[model samples]
Each structure stands twice: as structure tokens, then as C-alpha cells.
Target: MAVYVQRQLDRQPERTYVIEGDADGYWKLAQSLIHGEPYSIYTPPRRVLRMPGFPFFLAGAMSVVGEDHFRVRLILALSGAVACFVVYLLGKELVNETIGLIAAALTAVSPVMAGFSVLFLSETLFAVTMLISLWVLVKLSKVQFRVEDQFQGRLWSVLAGISLAVAFYVRPSWLLMLPLVVFILILSAKEHRTAALTRGLLIIVGFTVMLVPWVYRNYQVTGHFVPTTLWAGPSLYDGLNPRATGDSDMTFFDQENVLNSMSEYEMNQHYTKRAVEYARQHPGHVFELMGAKLVRYWKPWPNATQFKSFWVMAAVSVLFIPVVFFAGYGAWVSRDQYLLLLITVGPIVYFSLIHLIFVSSLRYRLPAEYSLYILSAVGFYQMCFSSRQGKELNPE
Candidate 1:
């Protein structure tokens, strides 16, 4: 196990540095953000938005070890170590120790997730923090929920919220899980409404407290009241940029395409305006885009695995649906039925919104991936140990 862990840890730095260079926004963004400078508009020059966690960690690493390859690689390897444990804890809640081990094993050697071991990407921090958040929720939801344990739950939930706050800090799109967490509160509060509501409120309160400072910082920088980061408008621009020149997968329904022949930013506004106008003008395309986006997000491509990074991600996303559905359905039939609904609804709604509008990238959805994996493991558990005669086996 030690050798395996070491090997996995050693493999990441070279690949991450190669794919996302050590210079440019990938490395410098961390330095800039940590020094309280302006966030890079295009760092790593691909999809890695200037998230909060990776740069901070890398900066800390730089302080200790200097900006050498050895330092960054070492930090990422340590990051992977924690991520592995988190996967185990998350998997343990859904199934047995064996499955927890399997899940961790999957995370440890996962060609996809293994990158966390080396690269200073948002996915690693997001994955680990998300695991902590979900594990806290699971631990708190037991029938033996005592006052002390409930207090502990409160503490953990607040901590989870902080972890999630860091997740959003790592990648703004992770805000999708916030709604899901809210759904858990709604479902959790059904039976113990007052207490659950109180806990839920406290959780949100904790999350809000953590988030406001960064938002205030963004507001100060951009002269706008932006609650999240500063990439959405530009990202929206990218989607429509190519569309105007017969390059996008989306087709224009009206003069909007013709008008979009302006600057990139101008074309973005045109597409945004037209999407709303066209939705009103042609509700069919809106619905079609919705359906089509869902398909685009899931449907396989030819020789997809060649883009190994995206290929594995698409498979993970597809598998996640089954995991969530089975676990969600099973939980609904149990005593803690509300948790089932909460677990399912918030994340789904959040994911649907992002998957629809934004460009579909694997890393974009990394935050919620842990939740689905946990839920899936639950589904796997229920499948392996079926009720001999309508009997449910609670792992507790």
C-alpha cells in the first residue's frame, strides 16, 4: 500500500506540469491570488479558473520549499494522500469497509483523480473538502442523534460548510452543491423540523460567514457586486464566440447569429440576449437546448478515451446517475426518506443549471462528483445485500 501510494503520488507532478504548465496562470495565478493581486483572467489558459484553495496551498509550499518542481510535486502528493482518506470515509458511510477500501483504491490509482496528487488544480481540494462535508452529513443523520452528538453535528456541519466555502473558493461553480445542502436541510427537518431547521440555519449561517469576505473582495476589485468569481461573463462569451462564425455546435434561430458577428464580448451579450429572446420567441429551442445539453453532457463520443482526462470524466458522470438514483430510491423507502430526497434534489438541480449553460468540462463539475460517488456506493451496497424479504440493512 505504501509503495502503491508513493508510486501514484510520484506520477502526477510531471503530467500536471506538462498539461497545465508550471508558468502562466497555472503557477502564477496562485502567487497573484495569495499576494492579494488581481485574479488572472486566463491562467493555465484552459479551464482552471482562479480558485481559492490550490493557489493558497501552492503558495504555502513555495514559502517552505521555493518554486522548484520538487516542492510543488511533494505538496500535491500530500494532497492526494488526504484525498484518498476522504474517499474512504465517504464510501464507508454508504457501504462496508470493503467498499470504502474499493472507493479509496479507485481514488488512489484513478488516472483521472491521481492528478490531484501532483497538480495544483482545484479538483483535489474540492474533492477532499466535499468528501468531508458529505461524511459529516451522514454521521449526523443517525437515529441515535444525541444532544452532544447533535452539537458535534452542528460543529461538523459548520465545518462542512466552511469546507464547501473553500470548495466554492476553489471553483465558483461548486455553488451548485449549496442548493443540494439546502435540500438536505429541508428533508432532514421534516421530522425534527425545529431542531433540523435550527441546524440547517446555522449551517447556512456558517457558510455565508465564510463566503462574504471573498465576495466583498471580488466586489472591490471589479467595481461590481459579484457574489461569485469573475469568469462567468467571459465564459459565456466563449460559447457564443465560435457559434457566430459557423463553429459552435449550436445553431442560430434568428438574426442573433448575424448580430453576433461583433467582438467576442459583444457576441456573448448577443447570444445571452438572444437565448432569452429566442426562448420566448421559440420555446422549442430552449427546451431542445435543455434536452440537447443533457444529451451532450452524457452521450459518448468516438474514440473518446483518447482524451483520457475528459473520457474518464464522462464515464464517471454517467455512472453517477445510476448511483444517485438507486441510493436515492432506496433511502426514500426507508425511515430516513427525506435524506434521500434532499441528497438527490439539491445536487441535481445545481448540476443541471451548470451543465446547461456552461461549456461541459470535466473539472467544472468536480465538486459534486464526490456526492454522486457516495450515493452510488450506497446504491451498490443495496444491490449487493438485498432484503431477503423486503428487509433493509442499515450499515450502522
Candidate 2:
């Protein structure tokens, strides 16, 4: 928190534009909400381009802080701290306090996590919500799927559902995680399929119920059942278009002047169709693009030019490289713990798969790094201290 505040303080005039790009949109939408104006950006007739979660949260902060970006950064820094503590709780639930503390410490010091924390982007907030959802799912994993234990199990499922819904609002891509989580829950209780199925349904019900209002609002504005935002089309096209380089560059929107000719909804549908058509017509190119995006998704260092400073690269690389190997080791040794592995490893896999189709970057992978830290802590403890303790952690 102190370091984040100090960094924000040191940036001077540019601090208002620190790590901007999407931050500008978020701040603008937030201001709209505060001043009771139309929610639109970039030559708007009130578009539903961005998700409401972060903007709404930011509006609350700006209201209290009177639109001071530094104060907003200070408030966001607290989300970073919450994420670290939640990672600790997740680690403790998965293993022991020692491993939990190690994971939390790693998250607290991670350059990528810290950098995104102070930014006005949704990653840090999403990370906190995602981690909390995973923690609830972990707790759900511990409960026996028996008729008598239905209350406890259902409660956790509902909490997990709510948390996951919150994450989805923050980042629409997370809606894809619902079916995967349901599959995991069902698979975990093979002998008690009825109970597991019931719990899964509860999760879906809880998740869907929470999203009803937002989805309805989207429907009202766009005349379509838009679950999250209309930005998906441009986001998808950003990765699959002919000029794509596996990086997000929406400048083509300006070159093509698509917005001037179409409504936001029409523009979203048009790009989505165009992107899909390009994928179908040029399968080979799509595969190559996917390959490039996969690399960008998993790269240890930032791909953005602004973050190319030698010290920045060194800090990211030094922290990430070791975590990669340690996390791999932890995953290997704990492969038998299917439930634990699902919650710890599932997110990175989910995000990686998503970014392989959408645009990819270190920023997209930040939310999943908390889970990586959990696994890395396991490896760190096993390699450095397990022998000293004279006992191995039982996967069961």
C-alpha cells in the first residue's frame, strides 16, 4: 500500500494518466456516474461498451474523494491489500498457515500485481473477487456432499456463486467459468450425483439471479440480452482481425470509422460476425494468431512498450521465472488433489484459453497470478522446508 501510494505520488503530472489506455475509459464512465451524465466514451450516444462494475465502484470512490485520482489510487490500493489477505486465506485453506503466508507475501510484492493494483483498471478488483470466489469453492470442496450436509454445502455454493457473479460483472470473460465450475462440482461427487447436481443447480441459480438486473439493463439499452457488455465484439476482433498481431490495438476502429456508420450494438454485432467469418475463412491464420496469443498470454514479462524499462523487465522476470518453476513443481506433487488443483490451476487455464482467442497480455493474466502464487508457495515449502518438517502434505 505504501509503495503503491509512493509510486502514484512520484509520477507527477503524468500521474493523472498513469498506465492509462483503458483507465481513461473507466475514469470517464465513473465521472459520468458521479455527475449523473450519460455513460458513454469516445464519441458517444450513450454506449454500453464497458462493464458497469468497476465504473460504479470508482464512482463511489470519486464521490467521496471528489474526483482526485490520487485518492482513487489510495482506495484501489486497499483492494490490492485485500487480494493479498484473501490469497493467504486461500493458501491456508489449501495447505497450512506457513504456505498461506508465503503466498500472501509473494502476491503483496509481485510487480505485475502491484502495478495493476494502482491502475484504474478492473484487474485488481477482479483479482480480489476471483480469489474470494475460489476460496469459497475451496471451502465447498471440503464439505461432504451428503443429504445431511446439504445446508453447509449449499451455503458455500451460494456464496461461491455470488462471488463468481461479482467477478463476472468486473470481467465478463468470467461468465465462461460457470459451466467449468459446475462440471468440477459434479465430477467431485460421483457417488452422490444427486447432491452434487443439486448444489450445481444452486450455484447456477444464485449466479443467474444476481446477474438479472444488469442483464436486464443491457437488454433495455441494446434490445438484446447482453450478459455483460457490448465490448466483446471489438475485443474478439482485436485478436482475430487481419491486421492483428496478437496484441490489442483498436485503432482500426478509427481507421475504419465503424462507429460513425453503426450504432454501438450494430457495431458490436458486425465486428463479432466479421471476426468469426475471418476465423472460418482463414483457419490457418486463426491458428497462427492463437499460437502467438498463447505465448503473449503466458509471457513472464510485460509486452507493452511503456513497461520495457530494464529495471521493470528485470523486476518482472526475476519474480515470475522462479514462480513458474516452483508452481510447476507444486502442481506435479499435488496432482492427486483434484479439488485443490481445480481451484488453484483452473483459473490460469481458463484465462489462458480465453486470451488465446481474445487479445493477450501480462495484464490479462494478473488475476490468475494469485492462484499461481498459491501453487508456488506449495512448491517453495516443499522444496525448502518439507524435509525439515519431516512430513509430506497429504493430498487427501
Candidate 3:
């Protein structure tokens, strides 16, 4: 891992290793926060196009390092280590120590994750926060809802919700996960429906409490209660527009110039309406685009031009293909353990479904890949060493 970081640092002027592309906004936001300037990437008007969690993280690092790219990469590399540790914890909670070690090792060596860790992107941060939240939820599942244990379970549930809120501040794609979690608990806790419902409500309260400040800020700026960001409309149209190809292309934003006569909020609503109308008008074309997105989302290589190399493709395929196969096998063997399946296999499914309506890329899937690694570890351990006499995994 240190060697990979050094290699990336050595490629200073390369766009892949430098602070370019989407990293621009994150770096700009961090500078704004550091210098006590307005939090807008543009001039004068404040905008919520980018989430603040990663920018806040970058701001702290910049305060300490003062624009030193090498030091910033080292800080993010430490975050990558934390992510691997959290993945191990989640794997241990889901299965056993051996599986946890295997999952952590795989995560530590992941080419895609290692590459992203040194860049000024939020995938690594989001992965760490999401894994911690997942680990808390897995622990919560084990706490029986007895009268004396109700308080403990509720507390864990609230912590899980707060962890999820932190992830949301990094990436808004996780917004639907809160409700999905409640639905999963309801389905899994069949006998304790009442208790489960109470926990679910508490989870909502916890999530809302953590996000109130951001929501209030958005409401003050946009005159509406915007729970997420204003970029969703552009993102949605990137996948649903008439020229959509299941990949992101923001050229329309500049070409259309609708913002010339509209507020940011108004532009958002306008693009959203246009995208929905286009999807409705061309259902067949929309379905085809979805199929294209599914292929792109699951392809065993990077989609970005900068990372398109034979060596990179070969390495990613070597890692990604085996993980997918073993994860499927793991899901099959653990089908009876509903909570295990929900925690280990849920995020990829959720993200896959959501990205069918938005832009799709391997970058959008890295945050959930850690969960897939846990499942992959289980399958590898089961197939290689476990007895074949139907001695099933006992996660309890």
C-alpha cells in the first residue's frame, strides 16, 4: 500500500494522480472553508452541489499541511487503512475472525480502492463511514429485544443512524438507505414487530437530528426543505435525457445555459421535469439505456480514460471477477440467514438499482464493494476449508 501511494505521488503531473476532474470542487471547497471564504465553488451565490463531509475532511488536512499534496495523500491513505479495519470488524460481526482477516486483506489490496485513496475523491471516506454504520447495524441485529435489552438495542440503532447520516454528508446516494434499513428490520424481526418498529422510528429520529443543520441551511438558501443537494436533477438528466448513453456528460449544463434566466433551485426543478418527461416519452430507449448502465456498472474494468491500461484492466479483472463469483456463492449458502444477507449483500443491490436511473460508473460502486468483499471472504473460506458435511455457518 505504501509503495502504491509512492507511485501515485511520483506521477505528480498526471491527471490521474493530481487534483483534477471532480477533485477540483472538493479542493476548492476545502480552500473556501480554510480561508473563511463563502462555501460556494462559484462566485457570490452559495450552492449545495457538492456534499460537505469530504470537503470538511480536506479542510482539516489542508489546515495542517497547507496545500502539500503528498501530506494530503498520506492523510487519505490513513483513512483507507481505517476503512480496511472497519471492513474486518463488519466481517467478524457477520461471520468469524478468519473471514474478517480475509476481508480486510482483500480490501487493503484492492486496486480500485488503492487508486482512489490517493486522489481527492470521497469514495474512501464514504466507504469507511458506510462500513462503520453497517458494522453497528450488524451488532444491533444480535441484541435480542428482551425488556432489559431494548434500551441497548435502541442505542445501537441510533448510533447506526448517526453513522449513516455521516455517510450521507459525504455522498447523497445513501439517502434511501435509511428507509431500506427500516424495511429490512421489519422483515427480519417478524416476532418482534412492535419492538422493531420502535427501533426504526428511533433510527429516523437520529438520522434527522444529525441532518437538521444541513437541511436548514439548504432551506434558508433555496426557500425549500432540500434534504440532499441541487445536483440531483443534473445527475438524473445525465442518465434520462434524450442524448443519454448511460454515462455522465455535463456538457448540456454549459450548452443549454438555462441558468442564465433561473435560480439554482429553479434550474434543478426544470431539468428534473425534462428528464422525467423524456423518460416517459421514450420508454424503450430508457430501457436500453438502463441495460447499458448495468453493463457499465458491473464491468470488470475502470471506465475512465486515464485508468484505461492493459495492466490496470488485468489487475482489476483478477480481483473483481473472483469477488463477484464468491459473493454469489456466499449469498446462496447464507440465504437462510436473513440478517447476514441484508447486511453483506444489500448495499450493492441498493446502489445498482438506484444507478439505473442516474449515471453509472465503477466509482459509484466502490463504496459498496467492501460489503461484497465480506461475502467473498465467506465463500472462499467455506469452499476451501469448511467441512462438506452440512456444517453451516453459525453467525449467532
Candidate 4:
């Protein structure tokens, strides 16, 4: 892990120095956090347009290391290393230690996973938070939900909720996962109705506690209640507009130049209304665009045209195909284990549905990739060892 971090630091300037416009905003936001200055992105009102978690994370790193570009990359690399360990824990809790190690190894070497860590983006931190949340839920699954276990089960549920809240702060779309997870927990503990209800309530409480402050801050800034960041409308429009081409293209709005004059809230409303009208007028086209997005979401290569390096793209495809094949086999073999299946397969399915509605890209698909590692490990173990042992690990 240390070696990986070092290599990333060495290549930081050449490999990861190209900051996208969105990333520039985040970097400036972190700088503002550090220097206590008013920061604006796109235009004035200078509010919390993006999620706050990653900016705060960058701020902490900059505070310690004086905001050097390499230092920021180092922080992300170390975070990636931590994610690898968290993947191990998630795998071990779901299956066995051998699977855990295998998952960790896959995560460490995955081209997308490793590359994301060195880039100035929120995906790495979001992935780590997501894994931590899953780890907590996996632990909670083992609890009996009996009277004796209620207190401990509630604690684990709260921790899961808190971790999920952190992830939500990193990416507002994560908010979609909360209810689905709660629903899974309810179904998993159907026999222990009282305990399940209590656990669910506690989890909601924890999540609400984490989110309320941010909500209040947004209200203060915008003079209206906003649950998450301000980018959702633009993001939605980015995928649904007439010129979407089944991927994110900010030029649709940029060409009009109306967003420049509007406040963030107004801009969001304008784009959202336009996107909805477009979808209404062109339902067949909307479906076609969604189909294209689904394909792009699962494609192994770089989704953007600029990053399409032939050899690198080929290598990613080579690595991704087998892992996905093995992962599918593993998911099939473990189909009977409800809790394990939910943890391993739920995010991929859920996020796929999300992209069907919004936008799709490799970067958008990353949070669920850790779960794929877990499934791939299971597939490898089943192919190599389960047959020899003549038994399967029961996910009770």
C-alpha cells in the first residue's frame, strides 16, 4: 500500500495534474475553507453548490500539508489504501478471510480504483465511506436482533447510518441508498419485528442528525429548504436535455448562456423544467438515451472521448471482463444468501437504475466497483475451492 502511494505521488504531476472544471471548483472551495474567504463557482450567492464532505476532506489535507498538488494526491492515495483495507473487512464479514484478502488485492490493483485515488475527485472518498457503511451493515446482519442483542444491533445500525450520511455528503445521490438499505434490513429481520423497527428508527435518527446541520446551512444561504447540494437539477438536465447524446454535455446550457445570469437555484429550476419538458415531448428519444447510458455505465473503457488511450483502454477491458464474468458466476452461486446478495449486488443494480435516469460514466459507476471485487472474490473461491471441499459457506 505504501509502495502504491509512493508510485502515485511520483506520477502525480504527469498523470493526475489535469484538473477538470468541476475539480477546479472543488480545489478552490478547499482553498476557501482553509483561508476563510468567500468562494464562488459559476456565479454569485457563493453557496454550497456541491456536496461538502470532499471539500472538507481536502481542507484537512491542505491544512496539514500546505495545499501542494502532490500532497492532495498523497492524501487520496492513502485514502484509497484505507479503502482497500475496508474492502477486506467487508469481504471477510460477508464470506471468509481468504475472500477478504482477495477482494483487497483486486481493489488495490484495479485500474479504475487506483486511478481514481490519484485524481481530484469525490469518488475515492465516497467509495471509502460506502464500504465502511456496508461493513457496518454486514456486521449488523450477524446480530440476532434479540432482546439481548438489541442495544448492540442498534449501535451498529446507527454507525451504518452515520457512515452513509458521510457518503451522502460526498455525493447526494447516495441518499437513494438509505431507504433501500433500510428496506433490506426490515426484510432481513422480519421475524424480529420490534427489534427491526427500533433499529430502523435509530438508523434514521443517526442519518437525520448528520444531515440536519447541512440542511440548515443551505436554508440560511438560499432562504429555502434544500435537502442536499444544488447540482442535482443541472446534473439531471445534463442527462435529459435534447442534446444529451446519452452522456453529460454541459454545452447545452453553456451555449444558451442563461445560467450565467440566473442564481444557482433559478438555474437549477430552469434546467430541470426544460429537461422535463424535453422528456415529455420526446419519450422515445429519452428511452433511447437511457439505453445508451446503460451501455456506457458498464463499458470498461474510459467514457469520455479525450481519455481514450488505446493500450490503456484495452488493458482495462482485459481486466474488467474476467472480473465481471467471475462476479456474475459468484452472484449466481450465492443466490440463496439474501443478506450477502443484497450487499454484493444491490448497489450495482441500484446505481444502474440511477444512471438510467440521470447520467452515466465510469466515474459514476465506481462506488459500486468495490462490491464487484467482493463478488469476484466469491466467484474465484467457488471455482477453485468450493468444488474441492464439496460444501459451500452458508450465509446465515
Candidate 5:
């Protein structure tokens, strides 16, 4: 993938520079952390810009390894390796170590998850943020009514909130995580008494603090106080509707490029209003879209590429025929454990809402897909264990 991105850059560095900034604004607010110098927004090919956090993360990696494109790709690969381990941590907390190992192994191999590891993108960043959030959630869920541990629960819950807030920074859609946080607090209240409330409040406070600066910056420049990326809603509306005219092969970014040229500021204004009005006037369309996108979320499989994401989808479909049922069984068997369901349901609900309300992007669906794998691993690892009980294994 680095080879591909570098080749594109070599051929037309001019096109890629726009990713660093656009006509709207610069990263002036977050500049100290993300870039070594005050840099203008440059257009990165569709591949790199999708992962905004990648350049910053990889820039650090480049500083250590030598400032080159290979360094960025190397860093992405390494972060992905670490992210798989993080998924293992989540799986271990949700199920058992065997499940954890299985989840990690699958993460390393899964086409969708592994595919992003090659780009200078934020898919890897988003994955790390989300997995860390889940891991922190699992820790905070263990919070109990030990009054003496007030500070402990508070700290853990704050950490969890910070994790969630960071995820939103990495991928703005993660803001939807608060609904699940609400459920977790309510469920935990009975067990932990007032500390649960304290935990919840602390979590909210933490997230608010983390999110304030971005909101303030948006307010400063745009006067609207948007949270993350400014373009997603209007971009999605135009990209998916009749206006985009993208074929099945084109990506969300490709459609956006053409739409960006064809449409102007006034069009985005119109599209924004129309998107809201459409959702209001035709609520059924929203539900229909949600269902369709959810299917796409699963069907085309995660590891789609220049050569194929649909074929990977087919393979996953065949593999998951039994995987889903076993997970349903395991989840049913673990019915009393809200942790399992909370982890499973949060991303699904969040992404479904994003798809229905906003524009659909394959990358937008990533966090939810990876979250599902932990549960899938529960079934896969368990079946592998049960079917092979008492059987001897040979080391390779």
C-alpha cells in the first residue's frame, strides 16, 4: 500500500497536498501535536486522508526511523500489530484468554482490519481508539460499591471516558458512544451505589473537557461549533444521492471529489437542509437506509481493496454462517452479563444511526465491524475448543 501511495505521490504530489488543509481551514488549532511545522492542508490521495491520525502518529514514527514514506507505512503496520493485541485485551475481558488470542489472531489476518494497516490513514487510529475505549470500559465495568475505592472507580471511569473522547477525536462518529455509556452507568448503579453516579458524572465531565477545544475551534472559524470533520454530513448526502452518480466501483472519496467540483458552498448548504428535511419528511427512508447500510456493513466484508472487498465479503459470509449462531448461543448463555451485550450493541447502534442520519462510508463502518469480531471470536474459539477437546496438538 505504501508503494501504491508513494507512487501516486511521486506522480502527482500536487494532488495529495490538499489533505493537509482545504479551502475551509488549517490544522492551526492542533498543529503543535500533528505536524512538525505549520503546514497548509494538502490533498492526500483518497487512501491517506481517510486516516487523518495516521500522518501524525507516523510522523513520530518517522522521526525515530528516518523521515520517509516507508517509515510511515512501517509505523502503520506496527500500530496495527499493537491494535490486534489491544483487541485481544478486549476479548480477554469479555470472554476468556483463548477468545482473546483468537480475536487477536483474527484481527491480524482479517482482510478489512489488516488491509488498513498499510495506509497512512486513521482507520488504524480509529481502531486503536475504539479498542482502547472498550478495554477501559471493561475495566470500569468492574467498578463496585466499595466506598473506600471512590477515587479508584472515579479514575477508572474517567479513563474510560477519556478513551471514548479520544476515539471521537480519532473518528468523530465515536461521539455516539455516550448512549452506551449512559446504559452502562444505569446498569452499574444498582451494584455500585452512588459511586456509579459519581463514575458517570466523572466520565461525562472528562469527555466534555476533551471535546471542548475542538468545538471551540470550529466555533471560532465556522461559527457553528461542529465537533470533528466539517464535511461528512453534506458530503454523504451528495455522495449517496442522485447527485454523486458514482458507479459500484467508485469509493466514497471518489464520489466526493466529483461532487465537490460539481457542487459549491451553496449546494452543500442546500444538501444539509435537504438531508435533515428528508430524514424528517421520509422517516421510512432513514430506516430503509439503515437496514441497507447495515447489510453493506457486513456483506462487502471489511477487507475490501483495490482488487476486491466484495469477494472478501463472500468468504466472510460463508465463514460466518456458523460463527453468528454460536455467538448468539454464547451471548444467550451469558445473558446476565451486560458487559458482553454493551460492547456488542454500542457500535452497532452508533454506526446504524450514522448511516441512517449521515452519509455512509466503508471506513465509518469499521469500528463496529471490529467490535463484532470479539463476539464472533467467542463463538469461533469456543467451537474450536469444544470440537477438539482431549485431542493432541502438534507444534509447527
Candidate 6:
């Protein structure tokens, strides 16, 4: 909290453009939402360029606090705190209380996480929402689906779906996780297949209920049934163009000059077509690009060009090495706990695959990074205190 407060006070004068174009875009979007006007100041008025979750939250904070940047940072700082708490709960649920405490402590002081809290980006909020969804899914996986407990199990599944729906609103990429989660539930509840299917149906119902209004709003404005945000095509093309360097490049779209004359939907279609054509024409280059993207997504250092100090980047990169090592060891040791392994590894896999097709950056990997803390805690506990009895000293 003190760190966040100090950073906010130090940077308060430049709050309006702290993160440059992205932060300014979010601020404009929030103002439009608060005023009940179209979100055109940043993108096309007819299309929703960005997801609505963080802007809505920021709009509420702005309304209550009278549009002050410090107050908004305070809200995000609170979210970072909540993310730490959620990591603790997730670690406890997966292993034991000791592991939970360790994970929470690491998350509380993580440089990447802390840096995000002081900015007006959606990464903090998205991390919190993703953690909440994972915690709920962990609870659901543990539920015993007896005939008498079917209602309780169904309720838990629905709640997990609702949490994930909130996460999807924050970052539409999470929508890809729905089927994966449902499959996991089905596999875990193999003894009661019918009950598992019922729970899955209820989850889908809950998710659809939460998502309908957003879809409807997009359709009404754009005259098309756009389920997610309208930037998918451009985002995909950003990584596929000939000048692509495994990081985001906005120059292709600018060079095309489609923004001035085309509708948002048309622009999206054009970009999609262009990216697909590129992939078709240069299959080997596409494969090489994906390999580079995987490296960028998982590399331990901050890859953004703004972090110019080599020594500082190397120091931060070194910090992540221990976490990565222990997480891999923890995953290997806990391989028998299939559901636990899924909970820890699912987000990493999901995000990696998505970024391979789009752009890869540290910011895009933030939501999954905390989950590694859970595995790291387990590894730390096992290495430091495991006895020769082949039993955990602090079993849940």
C-alpha cells in the first residue's frame, strides 16, 4: 500500500498520460461510459474496441471520487491486495495453509504486480478476476456430487461460471477457457456423469446470462452480433505482418489506412483476411513467428522497450528464475493431483496458445503469472521441510 501510494504521489502530475496511449484511451472510454455516450473518442463509435469491464469499474470510481487519478490508483491498489488474498486462498485449497501463506507473500511483493497497481491499466483487475474464477473452480472440483448434494454442486458450478464470466468481460480471451473448464469438470466427476453434465449446463446458462447484455449492446450499435470486442482481427494481424518481431506492431494497420474509410466490422474483416493470407502464403514464417512468440510470452525479463536499463531488466529477470524452477518441480511432484495440476497449468497454456496467434507481451501474461506462485510455494515447502516419511508435514 505504501509503495503504491508513494508511486501515485510521485507520478500524480502525469496521471493523465502515465501509460501513454493506452491509459489515455481507457480514461476517455470511462468518461464516455459515465456520460452515457458512444465510446468513439478512442475508436470507432459504432464498435466496442475494448472490453467494458475495467472501464465500467473505473467509471464507478470516478463517479464516487470526482475523477481524481490518485483515487483511481487507490482502487487498483485495493485490487492488487485482493489478488494476493485470492492467491493465498487458491494455494491453500490446492495444497495447505503454509503453501498458501508463501504464495500470498510472494504475490504481495512481486515487482510486476506492484508496478501494475500504480498504473491505470486493466491487468490488475483482470488478474483479480482470473484468480477469483480459479478459486471458484477449485472449490467446484472438490465438491462430492452425491445424489443428495447435487443441488450444492450445481450451485457451485454456476458460481464458478459467473466468476469466469466476469473474467471474460475483463479480457475476452478468457472465453476460450470455458470449454476447457467444462471438460475438466466432466473428467473429475466421471463417477456421476449425468450430474456433471447437469452442472456443466447450469454453468453455461449462468455464463450466457451474464454475457447476453454485452452482446446485445454491441449488436445494437454495430448492427452485427459481435460477441467479443472488435479488435481481434487487428490484434491477430499485429503479429502476422511481414515486419512482425514477435511483439505488437501497430504499423501495419496504419500503413493500410483502413481506419478512415472503413467501418469497424469491415476493418476487422480486412485485417483477418490479410493475416490469414499472410499465414497461408508464408507457412514457414508463421511457424517461426509462433516459436518466437512462445519465447516472448514466457521469457523472464520485461520485454517492453520502455524498460531501457539492461541491469534492471536482468535483475528482474533473475527474480523469476527461482519461481519458474520451483514451479516446474512442484508440478512434477504433484502430478498425481490431476485437478490441482489443471488449475495451476491451465491459464499458462491458454494464454500461450492465444498469444501465439496474436501479440505476446509481459502485460498479456500477468493474469497467469500469479498461478505460478501456487506451484512455487508447494515446491518451496517440499524442498525446505519434507521429511523421509513420504508424507507432507502440513497436509491439508
Residue-wise C-alpha lDDT for candidate 3, range 1-396, written one tens digit per residue: 545665665776455444365788888889989999877776335488888999999999999878876678889889998999999999888888878999999999888888788788999999998898888888888899899998899999899789889999998989998998898888878999999999998889889999999999888878988999888888899899888998889999889888778888888899999999999999999999999998889999988786788998999889999999999998888888777788777898889899899989898888899988999998887887676755766664
Per-residue lDDT tens digits for candidate 4, residues 1-396, read 334544654676554344367678789899988998764454545586788899899999999989887667788889999999999999888988888999899888887788778777898898899888888888877888567887889889898789889889998888977888778778767677777878888888889999999999888777878888777778889899877876777776567766568777787788788889889999998999989999999998878876689976986788788889989999899888777778888888888998998989877888788877889999988898889999885532
Worst 10 residues of 6 by lDDT: 39-48
Model 3 stretches astray by more than 4 angstroms: 1-19, 43-46, 388-393
For candidate 5, write residues 292-380 as lDDT tens digits: 66565544444334435557567545544554566676566456767787786567566766665444546566656566667777666
Tens-digit lDDT track of model 6 for 183-248: 777876767888898988888888999999999998888888888987889888888988887887
Query: CA lDDT, every prediction?
Result: 0.57, 0.86, 0.86, 0.82, 0.61, 0.82
Distance from true position, residue 137, model 5, in Å? 1.2
Q: Which residue pairs collide in model 4, if any? A: none
Measured on C-alpha atoms, candidate 6 has an lDDT of 0.82
TM-score of each: 0.69, 0.95, 0.94, 0.93, 0.76, 0.93
- Stretches off by above 4 angstroms in model 6 are 1-18, 43-46, 388-395
Evaluated against the true structure, the overall lDDT of model 2 is 0.86
Q: What is the lDDT of residue 118 in candidate 2?
A: 78
lDDT of 3 at 117: 86
In angstroms, how far off is 156's CA in candidate 2? 1.8
